[model samples]
Target: MHLFAMLRLILLGTTLLFSLITLGLAANLVDKLGDQWSFPGFAVAVSVLTILAVVPMIVIDLLRRGALMSWVVVELPIMGILWVLWLSSAALSTSVGLFLGDCSSFSFDSALESLCRQYSALQAFSWLNWLLVKTYVIVTLALAILALMKGHKRVWFSPVSDLSFSPTHTHSGEPKIPPPATAPGGYNPDPRMAHNHSASPSSGYPPNQPPTLYSPPSGQYPPQQQPYQSPYPNQGPAQYGSPVQTYQSPPPHAAQV
Candidate 1:
């Protein structure tokens, strides 16, 4: 995921850089070529080029965070604008060429007169320009609304703006877990079970048996008097307080005690 995120960031930055370069080239071209319909047509082309370039970045962002609907809300109108601009530019260029052909050799005054005379031709051009500008304005405003609606204030009109609509974390505001508390040696004996090492005399095993591990001595002994020895001689002598003890008693006085 980290590598994928880094890839996304690289792609997004590259897209922004490319968009700026294209825009700079567009500005220089517009200045050099003058502000004819062709210049605006180039502007439309640059916008479309920018939009196409960033689409992959937007798709990756959407897939990473599941923001598909938000993506649509922002991108659909921009696509519509591009379509209108390209379509209108082509149609209007053809219409103008046809309209001027009839008065091709006319003077400026005569051309103006002919232009005014052909109201249908004038109206066609007007409608095409209107649609082009109208689409631009509408798409721009829709993008603005989408950005605000998704709480992305910094990326309203930018070329790579769609990458900003990240999804809210589904696990946000959940409680965190602390590490498990442990005692020395990574062992945490339960307080209730910490002091239960004493042996019960009612069981066949004598109190002298080891607390954990035990084995009989190698010496031969009667089956009824199996050998037993104190496991913790350092603690104290073992007690033989009940009848369960079957071994030969140590000393009469010691056994009585």
Candidate 2:
């Protein structure tokens, strides 16, 4: 069990014990007094109500079941009601003259003194029960507020004992899965290429026996080449094999003579 849960159980059990004590004393006082006063009867009623309500809640909490009554939304209101009841019972008991007066000073009879002591005990337990209820309510409310502020909106619907107030803890949303490895320009590399890149040189094809290149199937051949054409269409082709003619300078001198 959680530390918080265990503490809650202990506090609840103590409150339950106090409620039982208050119930017994109030019932006995009511029987002896016979409805002469209304406070004792009120105390008896509140104690019975507390016992009936708290017993089932304690059982559910002990079982750690996710029942409707165990939810914070439901439990808070129930606890608030009980808090008010205990406070009223305590206040009414305090108002009685017997609770305030000294039992030994006033009562000469031993039985009457004992009865006065019971009234004092009853009043004390009623206040103690109210204080216990108040403490639980305040602590629960503070935890709920802290959880809400930390983005745990669903905490209101969840069991108080099961919740953690740590800022690092998350109650909702799925765990994020990281995206696949990507290259520059948003390209995802092929798994095979990545494997090859990471593989040891000795594990792959030998350095001399490189991987084979793709070839055409069976009898297919490349097409024949076409003849080349000159860019200047009007120019004649040069005669490279013919000899060059010599210049006739003597014919010009013969003409002058």
Candidate 3:
């Protein structure tokens, strides 16, 4: 556990004990006096409220302390309210002359002296509880302010017990960096340059290798293409007309021999 957390628990335990004591003394006085005074009743009320509030918080700190359970938003307000309550109770007791005179002044009557001592005790414990709460609240607020200045904005909603008042890092304790882009065969490629080997020269691809031509896959041949025929053909002579008759020459030379 953190040192702050342990200290906080110790303070809470002490405050709870003080509140219980104050409650007992106040209740006893109120029962004996029977509404003759209002401060004792107010003290009883404050003590009851303190007990009711502190018990649940102690349980939370013990069993279910977490970001949500121990959130600053939740815890600080309760502490501040209790601090005010205890302060008011203590101030009221003092202003009502509960701690005005020495207990021995009432020595003429044993009962009066005992009651005076109890009143003094009640006032003392109320002040003590107020001091405890005030100290815790001031420390917590100071740490919160430090955390904010240090850029731990999440600490406002984070568990009080887990605050470090510093910038938190990843689990590995190093700043997170993105993985480099990689190509096949474990080749790390520069992100500023394209990885396409066949990209044009203007496209910023490296000119180390000449561009290759597209070819059919290995072990596979292209399908044979049929011969092309013209859509228009020449007309045949028989389709045009019959052959023209040729002029006949008689064999006149055989008669002369």
Candidate 4:
């Protein structure tokens, strides 16, 4: 898109330069010819040509940012103004082209012929003045029409960047996942899964043995055994009992003796 925009910028600059040159030459020609429409025509031409000069730069800049509407907004008026410029200049230059083309054939006073053929500064010898004006006029008209069309902008020069109205991401993001369907009694919808889900000890564990709520007698996890206690009475702890001190009582016979 930037490439396209840049190309458009280049085209615009080229057109702008052509337009400036044409405006200058045509204005000079009108001035030298001393035609009746020269004053007002040049006035409009100057103002419109200023717009022609300035707006393309603005449009090209706007295009880089993908401001299509903004570009259209400024460019629509530019197109309209260009239409006026084109038509006005076309009429003026076409008349001049005809005059210059036929001036030699027509029989007129020497002074009148001289005036008609007069070119003050590089008007006749440098290049064809009417041709430049006419070319610029046609170019302006073509660009104007192209600007008004929606698809033409992209086709003319592909913009490297652009704005889009459509959403880039889904509106609600990730889709919601539903719970798996169940049977009439809330069993799994699938028979195999339901069977696996309802495994029992008497029924035996499922062969694949997927996770389930039913506990079987130890297919994978064995029940832990508790240590057995000895049932004999002598088996209890006696080492830690208090030491009994038995006093040897003097025998009664000894005491009596």
Q: What is the model-wide C-alpha lDDT for candidate 3? A: 0.78
- List the candidate 3 regions with Cα displacement exceeding 4 Å: 165-257
Off by over 4 Å in 1: 36-222, 226-257
- lDDT of candidate 2 over 1-257, digit per residue (tens): 76767777888899899999999999889887786888889999999888887887789866767787788888888888999999998898888776455787757688788778878888899999999999988888888877776667677888867654443334452322345676565655455555775674433343455566678876598777899885544434557996654444567769899
Query: In candidate 2, which residue pairs get closer than 3 Å at backbone N, Cα or C atoms, i.e. clash?
Result: none
Whole-model alpha-carbon lDDT for candidate 4 = 0.46
Model 3 clash pairs?
none
Say which prediction, candidate 1 or candidate 2, comes out ahead on lDDT: 2
> Candidate 1, 83: how far from true, in Å?
12
What TM-score should be assigned to candidate 2?
Answer: 0.65
lDDT of each: 0.46, 0.78, 0.78, 0.46
Model 1 lDDT tens row, 1-257: 44323544554455445444434544543454466536334544644564564565466555654444234445445545545654554455455453444454455677454543442333343344334435444544555555555555444333333332242222332222334457555654344433452343233333455545556777666467667976533544556884443445378889678
Each model's TM-score, in the order given? Answer: 0.26, 0.65, 0.63, 0.37
Residue 131 displacement in candidate 3 (angstroms): 0.6
lDDT score for residue 103 of model 1: 52
- Measured with C-alpha atoms, the lDDT of residue 58 in candidate 4 is 54
lDDT of 3 at 115: 91
lDDT for model 1: 0.46
